[model samples]
Target: MQLTAIGINHDTAPVALRERVAFQFEQIKPALALFKEAWSGKRSLSAPEAAILSTCNRTELYCATEAQSSREQAVSWLSQYHGIRTEELAPHVYALPQSEAVRHAFRVASGLDSMVLGETQIVGQMKDAVRTASEAGALGTYLNQLFQRTFAVAKEVRSTTEIGAQSVSMAAAAVRLAQRIFDKIANQRVLFIGAGEMIELCATHFAAQHPRELVVANRTAERGMRLAERFNGRAIPLSELPSRMHEFDIIVSCTASTLPIIGLGAVERAVKARRHRPIFMVDLAVPRDIEPEAGQLEDVFLYTVDDLGAIVREGNASRQAAVAQAEAIIETRVQNFMQWLDARSIVPVIRHMHTQADMLRRAEVERAQKMLARGDDPAAVLEALSQSLTNKLIHPPTYALTSAPANERYLLKEIVGRWYSPR
Candidate 1:
């Protein structure tokens, strides 16, 4: 079977497009099942293995199949699911086959390919995707081994290098940007627009400043309340955002909503209510929780995930040495993984050889049993069994040698000579 990965990410596509294709955690299991069914049915393939990794920055499909046609089928399925034209999505999609696919998976799981280098969250996200696929019965031996090694490489990367040290996280960068707008973070009120992990992290960083007030707004009141309680803040339903948005000076939002949660009109109303006070906003969502027009407003300072890329580049000099060391470790591991894959590719041939040998041995044992049961002398039966076994072992080689063409015989001699030569 061949391994393949096809998808788009932050580098290849805009947040708008990425969000359109993003698969929520709840949707993953069903999506994987559908993908497997589609590919299997279209290509006459059965039990094709597949896993999907969807995050704010990327959506990817990793699959193992016997034919290239399966890859094309998977691409069409992804385009159809997202309701986008195949050609439109094709440009942004990357297809890696065999060893390249294996390398890509390892790099991604190791955080070498993350939006924020060395970010640890992608590792967990990858594992969750694998678990979902396995439970759905879409994972097979090849994929299982591939993912297991990917996780192992990630762990080794984390333990052997300081790649994560001195790294500026999106949450920390959001706080830093807010401080630039407001003289004292402790004096400002902070509002988090979602209860997801990104929002929780942003809240943690901003809460360290002991902000005057902290509030969490979420579609689910229970989830909002849970996150709010952690920061000694209050929870508000998302419906109340428009009316109560002006109360906070800082807004950090990262939601899975398809549309912009905070539009230009909402921000305009909020700015007017705040008496034109500057509102610091960071949108970590792919589709963008805040509208682009909101950034054009006079008193609103808006920053998207792309905007924070520059800020997160700080203090990287100190980690350069660590990155080099980590890369070396990855390179060695990648080579070993390739060797394992090579061995896996020949497993069917190995199984066939063992089966053939078992058949020959069974046939010889049956003949020896019949001779002993016929009342022949035990010594004669043993001699006959030994002769039969020897003939069975040498017959094929002897026939091949005697019937071979001149060139074939020469090639056979060369092969046997090399086999018997000293290492």
Candidate 2:
């Protein structure tokens, strides 16, 4: 079987495309089931082992299959599932096989492949995706082993290297950019949407700046209150945003909602209510919590996840050496994984060999039992059985060695020698 990684990421596609291709957290289970059903039907066998890793920056499908051409099939399935044309989607897709796939998985887990270099959030996101896949019954030995090693390599890299130092996360970048706009975060009123990890991080950073007032709005009031209380902020229902948005100078949103929650009309109304005061906004969601049109407003400084790329790159120069170390470690791990894959390939051959030997032994034992039943001498029967078993065990190699061509005989000799006395 071959290991394949097929997908597109922030490097290859714009957020406009990335958001369109992204699978919502709730959509993953059913999508995986559909993929498996289609894959098994197309291949005329059970579905190949598969897992999907989708985030704001990337969407990837990893598979282990005997059919090398499954890459194309996967792309087709993705396009069909998302209702996009294959031609439009194929341009940004990358299909990595074997060692390249292994390398990519390791790099991703290590945060070498994130928009924010060495960001630790991707690790949790990957684990969550894997858990969903496992619940969906999409994982098998190959993908399970691949992810386990990917996690181990990530842990080693983080502990032994400085890849995460001086790293500016999206949340930190948002705070920095807001500082540029507001001069003093202590004077600003901050509003956070959703209670996810991103929102929590952003809240922590902004709270440290001593914002005058902080508020968290979420679909679930209980969850929102929990996160809000952590930073000494108040909680509000998402439905109240239209009325309450004008009160905050800084708005940060990251949610799993498939559609935009903050629209042009709502932001326009909020800007009007605030007497055209500047409102700095950061949207960390993939499909986007804020509308694109909101960015066009003069008083609304709306920045999407893609807009933070430049800010996140600010301190990356210092991480070059650490990236090199991480790469070296990843390369070694990739080679080890490939070696394991190679060993797995010969398992069927080993099984066949054992089966043949067992059959030969059973046949010899039955013949000796017949001889004993016919009143043959027990000592002679035992000796003949032992000699016959030994001869049968060595017959194939013995015959091939004696009948081999002169040039091939030396190669056979080495193999036969190893069989009797392994190195």
Candidate 3:
């Protein structure tokens, strides 16, 4: 089976479409179970081994299968699962087969493919996806090894290069975007929806400005409270979003909810209450917590994850040296991984050759032992054993060279000659 990576990302699709196929971190395992059931018995794909890497920027399925059409099948499955039309999704999806898949995996893990070049967050996200895949029993030898080497390459890239150090993270970009509108963050009230890692990071960055107020609203009240406490802020229930959203000047939201949490009406009302005051908003979630239409409102300066890409890429030119070094490391690792895969593909033939050779050696040894027991000369018996072993080992190739078809004889002879040639 070949390795294949199939999916759409920020580069290929809009946030509206990417979100349609995006899976929440917690939703992966169960989704994999559904995947297994869907592909349980098939002609092109059987017992499909796949690991999904779903993040704010991308949703890719890394699969081990011989199916030449696995990419199309994956697209079909994604559309069906998400209730999206195939024609709409087909154009944006990219399929990387074999070496390309390996290269893509390595690049993604190393953060070379991220909007924020060389950011470290993708490493953790990939590890989590891999762990979840393993837990879901979606992993097999091929995928397991692919990710192992992928992680090793990622580590090498991060350790050997300064790309990661130079990255302006999403949280940092969000802060910078907010600063574009608000002259002083310290005077603005900030509202953060969702207490996930992204939210925590954004809150921390904004807190440094000593914002007048920092509030966290999450599905779980306690979780929100805990995250809020870390920044000396307060927590509110998700239900309070509509009523209290107008109170804050800057709102950053990222949640796992499948639907929009902050709708157009909510933002419209919040804008009305603020009396035409500008409100900076950032939606980091893949599916997004805030509605896209909400961004059209008069007082709302809303940005989605994609909208922050330009800000995060501010100093990429300065990090070109690190980027080049990281790319070199990734290229070497990709070649090594492909070589491992090539070696892996012939493992069954190697196993059979060893098994057959062992059986022949054991049989010859048994015959020689019987001769020795019959009071034969020890020197003669030893000579016979060595001779028998050599002959038996050479027999298969000798027979093949002689018995090969007329057109194939020359090639077979070359193979046999190479096999028996001097070192």
Candidate 4:
């Protein structure tokens, strides 16, 4: 079987495009089933295993199939489902096969490929995606084994390296950036526009400063209220954002909406209402909840995912020793995994050889029984049996040595001799 990964990530595409393709956890099962059905029809391939990983930074499909056609079919299905132009999406996507795919998965699970280097959240996200795919009937033996190993590798990387220790999270970086703009975080009014994990993290950081006021606006008021209550803040319906936007000095938004929730015009009005007071805004959503044009306003400061990357890089020097150790571990683990894969590829050949040997052994045993029944000498029967077993064991290799090409014969001799020679 061939293993492949096709997807776009923060490095390849902007949040605008990434958000358009992101799938929520609840939507994954049905999506995977549909993807598998479409792939099987187009490629004429049997049931292919598939799993999708979608985060704010990436949307990827990892698959195991019998042929290359299955990989192409999966790519086409993803492009069609997201309504993204194939030409535009193709360049950003990386399609890895076999060993390369295995390496990519290991690196990703270890957080080497994350936007925030060494972020631990991605491992849980990967696990969730795997669970969802299994429930959707998309995971088969190959993908199941691949993902299980991925988790183990992630655990090893974290335990051996300080990759996670010195890294500043995006949420914490957002607060740090806001502090640079304002004299003190306690003097700013912070507003969070979603009730998701990212928003919760941002709220926690900002609340530590005891901001003047904290508010949460969400599509679901009940969810918003629960999150806001934890910080001793207030919650507002998304619909109320237009009128209430002027009250906050700092805005951090990360919502699952396909379209921008806060636009240029709304920000313009908010600035006018506040008499042109400076506002710090961070758009953490993949397809940003805040409008891109808002970054152009004179009194508005807007930072996207790319902008926060530098701030998160602080203190890397302290972690270099740990990173070196982690990389060495990953390299050794990768070699071992590849060895397993190589052995797996030859299983059918090994089985066939064992079957042939078993057939020859049974025939010789039957002959010996007949000789004993006929009252032949026991010593003669034993000698014949030993000679027959030796010949049968050597027949295939001996025949090949005579008939094979010179290079192949030389290679086979070396292999067979080494395998059978005394230690």
**Which model scores highest in lDDT?**
2
Model with the higher lDDT, candidate 1 or 3: 3
Per-residue lDDT of 1-423 in model 1, one digit per residue for the tens?
Answer: 888989999789887788888887788889988887777777677858899999887899999887763446666788899898988787888888887888888889877777678899999989999998988888998899999999999899999888897678889998889889999999999999989989998999999999999999999999999999999999999999999999999999999887898889999999999999999999999778899889999989999887886787674667778878877887888789889878987999889978877788888789888888888898988887788777887676678777999989988778767755899
State model 4's lDDT.
Answer: 0.87
User: Where is model 2 more than 4 Å wrong at Cα?
Assistant: 399-409, 421-423
Model 2: lDDT equals: 0.93
Task: Give candidate 1 regions above 4 Å deviation.
Answer: 69-71, 395-423
Descending-TM-score candidate ranking: 2, 1, 3, 4
lDDT by residue (tens digit), candidate 4, 291-374: 899999999999998788778766455777876777777778878887887788799899999999999999999999999999
Tens-digit lDDT track of model 2 for 310-337: 8998879889999999999999999999
Per-model root-mean-square deviation over C-alphas: 2.7, 1.8, 2.8, 3.1
Poorly placed runs, candidate 3 (over 4 Å): 44-46, 66-69, 358-392, 403-415, 418-423
Better of 1 and 2 by lDDT: 2
TM-score-best of 1 and 2 = 2
Error of 4 at 348 (Å): 1.8
Instruction: Give me the displacement of residue 84 in model 3, in angstroms.
Output: 1.3
Model 1 Cα shift for residue 205 (angstroms): 1.3
Q: Which candidate, 3 or 4, would have the higher TM-score against the true structure?
A: 3
